[model samples]
Target chain A: MAPSTTTTYTTKQWILASKPTGAPVLSGPDATFKLQTVTLPPLKDGQLLCKVRHFSNDTGLRNFIQSTVAPERFYVPTVPVGSPMRSGIIAEVLESASPSYKAGDLVMDFHLGTWSELVVLEAATSQKLAPLPKNLSLTHYLGAFGASGLAAYTGLKFAGGAKPGDTVVISAAAGATGSMAIQIAIHLLGAKRVVGIAGSDEKCAWVQDQLGAHACVNYKSPTFVEDLKAATPEEVDVYFDNVGGHVLDAMLTRVKKHGTIAVCGAVSGYNSDEPMALRNWFELISMRINIKGFIMLDYMDKAPGILQELIGAVADGRIKLQDAETMVEARIEEQPEVWMRLFSGKNQGKLITNLIV
Target chain B: MAPSTTTTYTTKQWILASKPTGAPVLSGPDATFKLQTVTLPPLKDGQLLCKVRHFSNDTGLRNFIQSTVAPERFYVPTVPVGSPMRSGIIAEVLESASPSYKAGDLVMDFHLGTWSELVVLEAATSQKLAPLPKNLSLTHYLGAFGASGLAAYTGLKFAGGAKPGDTVVISAAAGATGSMAIQIAIHLLGAKRVVGIAGSDEKCAWVQDQLGAHACVNYKSPTFVEDLKAATPEEVDVYFDNVGGHVLDAMLTRVKKHGTIAVCGAVSGYNSDEPMALRNWFELISMRINIKGFIMLDYMDKAPGILQELIGAVADGRIKLQDAETMVEARIEEQPEVWMRLFSGKNQGKLITNLIV
Candidate 1:
């Protein structure tokens, strides 16, 4: 293939249409899918035009969209409508106007916009992509070894405060962040007992079998509360809250005195029109519990070190990666269906979109 | 004094007939004042016979009563019917079988059955009461310089992590614990802005003028939320929460990031037949706030030192004490009405029932 010319090229793209009232819908009045034919604007002095290789889809993207539409609710305004959807993408530079980057260099760019086929991004925002380590897939960069990886690592390291012989309970234990947190707590932190709360029995089994979790309780089970209490006879020391709502309430009741809760996400209530009510907050005062909420953006400086350590663990076979394939290779319409699969509890492990074959 | 006899003596005492369902009725079937004529049991080898002088009336007493009637909710077995009411009291030793104490020595005792004429207590549990400094009233031992004083100092110092120039918002600002917490935060801790929340405007005014709070907000006012927000524009850094119903919910919405809330008591919902529901708990996760519940018993070791410091502060005029005197002399019948006065907002400053005229 002769070198792709930046002078004339068309790329498929997706853009936001209107503000979503509740759960986002695909190809609806609220969300317009535009297959736009656009020319690449001339690169500035410190910019590069790149061919998109792979991109990430994250749960936080919805919050980001809402934040953009409603600025008053957040400390900062969210992404504006008609602007390129914020994403992290692996790409190959086809043309460069900066001394720091050259044509043909592979890199990761945070400003990769619009789920597009081709794009131009600022040179300062791109970091040269290192080759994927042996046994570690390129997709790991989008999941465990990327922002998600640092999020789990730092959250557990700082907030969990997990000491040896401590009991750790994690909700949403099969998802990207939850899976990593469980493993770190058990194998790395030397936690005595590791209990996981997942959406389904299969996810629970996966966490137990693949993550070395001492016990797994399916939140959907009728005996979830009993099972949780039985699993942690001495009360949970660290609660990694990934799925809030009823699961959070259950954890709050069972947490020990002086326990720490890392509030990473609330996937369980994200799609609900009315959030669940918390009736047992008085327990918080009686138990002297500590709850801390944070996003990965606050700890960006630790990304490189966390990624290196994660890569080593994967290479040594000490940490196992559970890859959940939800992507449909046949058509683009399947993208919306793949995203919906997460809500139905059909998807396992880290779900990603495979754009190229 | 006839050299207070070590010989057993018979005296009349009140016992718990039944647990109160809601607001404790002074003369009712649930809590009958039984004048049991019984001989004072001989003290054990390391015990002392404490002539109960002043019994403390605390919010915890309500929980103790409820727990006594309903053992299932309590951590331990309930206090049996006809047993003396459990309480903390300042007493004088009439007779001692232990070498640690002698007759006439004043002490603070935690052995229950304080709604009586006498008590048999462990010598180790009895802390020798320090001599009252000049200008410090003996009744302060049952209120300001007693459990309430230590609770406020410890909660603000450790749980609240209060720093100078920080804004501290205290609930139940005119009651025993609330008043002590305000004085500690303002005088002892050197906080810049102190905001007090009370049930009525008169109590709020008293808190500002008598207790030295920078601003006071009446929770009963229609403009309560607005006034609180305006008074604490910098946002509350340390919240000493005593009233935990709607007042806590409102305070939760205004806490700054990384703020600490010391959940000392929930007086607002203490007497309710049903516990109140908190609406704004989600703010805890987003704000990364830390809320801790504590009992004075947990920090009992620090009591003597804390009491000495408080007494010194009062003596040196570093902190001014507000005397909310309900009676010049304490009597058995006055106990119920004295406590009821607190709920009705009838007393100003620190409410105390003087046992000695």
Candidate 2:
């Protein structure tokens, strides 16, 4: 009954070696990440070993790295210097000592320190993903059908109050959450108009063409203000902000009376020490705008229901699975370079790293 | 029956000859106000002539004067160069040409250009007060039983959502609206702790001692920040902000999660061309505070019911009418100086002008 002794397994992980003062340069000697290889331990009772098939690169990692500084700490704690950098992961159970998981069973883990070829976790840690139905990839669980999708659903439903015929403006529209938000607003919420703000022309094009957003404004354009104005002819009814700072200020002037703004992320200021000054904040009084800060961790209870709805939508073709136009693939060893794409806006859709390479 | 001839009535008015570049100086040759004498016009059908008794000096008049600047205009129109300055007035009917009114009827007239001694109005233009009930003075209609009282009632009930055990902070807490707000928060809403922010120690003392607020912080003191911090040991629940700017910034940092800020006015910026920057606006996101701008004009429909409750509270011993410790008195001729006292924070309690002098 002993397992085959011929093959041995080793795990490779990217550990946080130092705290970053600014944006982390992944390839330098002073890089924040350090790669390490180690032998796998025998599975303990109530534990399972998973081969992390895909790593979900996220902009929130910027906040994670800064958590070492208490005053500047964000909503959550950072990955320790000697531990694996944390992220959402799509994995398959390779070995199991728990009754809940068996070999070859797939799962989705959220913030379980996932930047590794193989990770051992307590059986209670991750949700067991059902078999990947037709037209859905294993990577979809880390994106369109996962936490980001649930956030888009909850934020738009409760915070944005997105309704039929509403004009919704979403920042970071080509990123993971934004892509899902745009599709949900258009296909599910029946939004009359959806305008997106993205950094590059290609990303903007993908956001408009693939995600079915009505318009996409390149935030890097020289005529960004004018483009934004043209994109939103009428006052905006709901604003889903991801990249805050000047974009938020510009939208403050554009939100209609009694409009709502869902503050999802502020990636623009994550790298800077100084918080940007919002000059037109008085408009919050004049226009009666309601701005609410949102975090997905607070709404975990709604995830099961939201994920169910998303899975059905994806399967029935109501939500186009191809909406994610680009899935940039990289080897597990290339995670440092791949993650930089998230902050640099180089990834078109979701960025997934393959563990097999 | 022919009425015996009596003393002729002459109307005194203050007209705005030019727009102010900054705060209007009343005594200078380039004064914003110009006093004029005019003969009383004959009352037309459905018209009544009233002698104005008391003029209500409100900071909102600052916005009224600003109406000439098209885009920045307040809820109503401006007092044109040839017209008398506008204000809420208490008046007695001297002559009636309509069945609805008769001689000696007391009434409250809103925006009736009270900077004059005698005025003619259509019978339908004013709310005729019931016969002078005991424990009520003519001045009460312009103060505790007037617009400010109604504002405090509705603002606390809805905008601020003040309730029992709620710790409330009222900025400009010794002024007309603020004084009423303090009493309403303490007596009506049963707020556990009420803090007042006033300009001087005398005003602060009166606000605390007479208005029944738990604590008062003089914003003019050298240790204002420490004083405010000591006054509010816990995160504030409801902040009734009347003076917005630095005070608003300070409160933004101290507000608890889901706190509500009723932004009734921004007195600090009324005289300045530049709007002050809210540096801690990000707190709106982190704390999830809701800041609502309230204009009483929008809530006119709620006035009748609210005024009835306020009048009853004043008639009973529940609300002390003598709570206004400093009712700064001024002669009708010193209207310009009295109005200037409002902007300079020289007046305590409500600023009332006696028309007979």
Candidate 3:
């Protein structure tokens, strides 16, 4: 809260120290972040100050730093060097000079520079999240009910055109968006079978046993293709592709006639300089598959309805919030390390760093 | 006409002699066709005998021969070696035993073996075209009123979703379907600027001057990309792609956001053992371009309506059958050579063979 006394607050943030050479690491000569503190300026007439509660890590952050040479090339606004990293965050208002936001207001900023101890913005910029239900945790607001959740839901509904009894497959099935996509395919869309592609046996087990998916395959396993085939004998009707590359190619070969691929992310190639060589692209014509690449920004108008349905499903237990059970939590200082877990496949479920206790 | 005497009739046909080593040749070690003769069998119940009047040469004929080793892979059935070459044909009924047809009837058979002087089939197997309109020739039934016409119309209307004022570009713009596509995009679809990509300057001139396309680019020129850029300053809104190789890749770079690419054919790769390397396929996701590869067989139910509209357009001079001017007429015995003109980009317009005349 702002004090009448001449007291000032300083904000700590993780800035883009340098571009990563390849896949990012927390402690290396090629490390891509630097921590810094800045003195907060007086609140402007339309400005509001927020204390970051929790912010979600995204593979897109890697793309942001690497894509700085051509920020306009990406869908989202890229974070400039020396600027605090941009991310989706759930935050509490600490001070407000605007009529729209008051102290203690919980807001979700999809475009905010949130890998920091504090965020200050015009009240109109961020969306005030609805009050959390008693049964659902605030993590749901960041994972299953936030941008990642909306990505999974909209990508399936709009891109994949998820229908009842469709055999849906999700890559990166242990990640925040993929896990939600797996459950959405089953509970909301009534998919006949759901296959999850993860990177480890533990993640695969959790994806299958904890998430109610029909099967889960470790993509790192030698029998990855065989396992995927065995799991989806009828062939995939909707492939919610989060990890594009070899996984996308494999699904392309197996997609049923008129199947759709919801390309939400390409995590596998975000760190690489070369565009992945896709062999099975010809199948896009052969099987008459529809490959739609989309971002949540394109589906903002549909977000409210999707969020409502997702919240209702999670509350009614139709959607098991398995991401909460295996949650990976870290402090604001560990943002780089926690985010690295996403790239290294060490993170379990939704990876978030708590900026405030 | 049936023979007045009880003399037996022998039908001459072109049969698949052997698979081509590469692109087929009419007279070489790589010759893919052979001439054969067989006595016409007596008409059975519900059967009719017809003499092939004119047969259309399609780029798909190349795929048919190449796909024979694995016939099930292609959308249409493949022709076996030693069997008559199959194609779309306009024929005249010589005799009939079914009530559906009678002697002297004009029929259109999409799946008939047309590289022959005669064909016999059940009356239900072919559609009896109405009496030829006074303003139209028999070639109209095989071009503007037949499968190629439907391919162009359906590709632009259904697959491309071509709309008024859209900047439509058609690859292989001097070929059969592309020629019609150029006109349909301008006259029917009301595209503001239609760009045609042909292989030669003469063909490009005909595409722009005769076919009413706003501009035509000779793709074989070393400055093809620059020429295409100069021609389509506003960029492409709908690309009716008949050639899928470097040209398709080039178009992908110039396509407007949310453009549609109707994959009608890939003549560049038909005879080559190597799959054309496509580098810009990622644009399919970035631009949210819809790339649909289709066969006319999928839209046969809509063929009649398309044919009716096309016939009206032809008669009204709305679609300049300018293609009729450059028609490549070949004897039935020269089917192999005429078909090579499709891959070689030597045929000017709708390539057809005179079977009876």
Per-candidate iRMSD:
4.8, 4.5, 4.1
Candidate 1, residues B150-264: lDDT per residue as tens digits? 8888888887889998899998888878888898898889899999998888888888988889999999999988988898888889999987788887887788877888888
Say what the RMSD of model 3 is: 4.7
lDDT of 2 by residue, A88-191 (tens): 88788988889998999887787574678888877787888876678467678778877678778888877788999999999999888898999889888889
Write down the lDDT that model 2 would get.
0.77
Native-referenced Cα lDDT, model 3: 0.78
Candidate 1 at A242: error in angstroms? Answer: 1.9
Instruction: Provide the lowest-lDDT 10-residue window in model 3 chain B.
Output: B66-75
What's model 2's lDDT at A291?
Answer: 75
Question: In candidate 3, what are the lDDT values of residues B25-49, reduced to their tens digit?
Answer: 5776666888888887777789778
**Which wins on lDDT, candidate 2 or candidate 3?**
3
Q: Docking category for candidate 1?
A: acceptable
- Residue pairs in steric clash, candidate 3? none
The local distance difference test score of model 1 is 0.72
lDDT by residue (A118-148, candidate 1, tens digit) is 8888888778777777745676777778767
lDDT of 1 at B212: 88
How much is the lDDT of residue B321 in candidate 2? 64
Ranking by TM-score: 1, 3, 2
- The residue-level lDDT of candidate 2 at A63 comes to 65
Quote each prediction's TM-score.
0.85, 0.80, 0.84
Per-prediction DockQ: 0.27, 0.22, 0.23
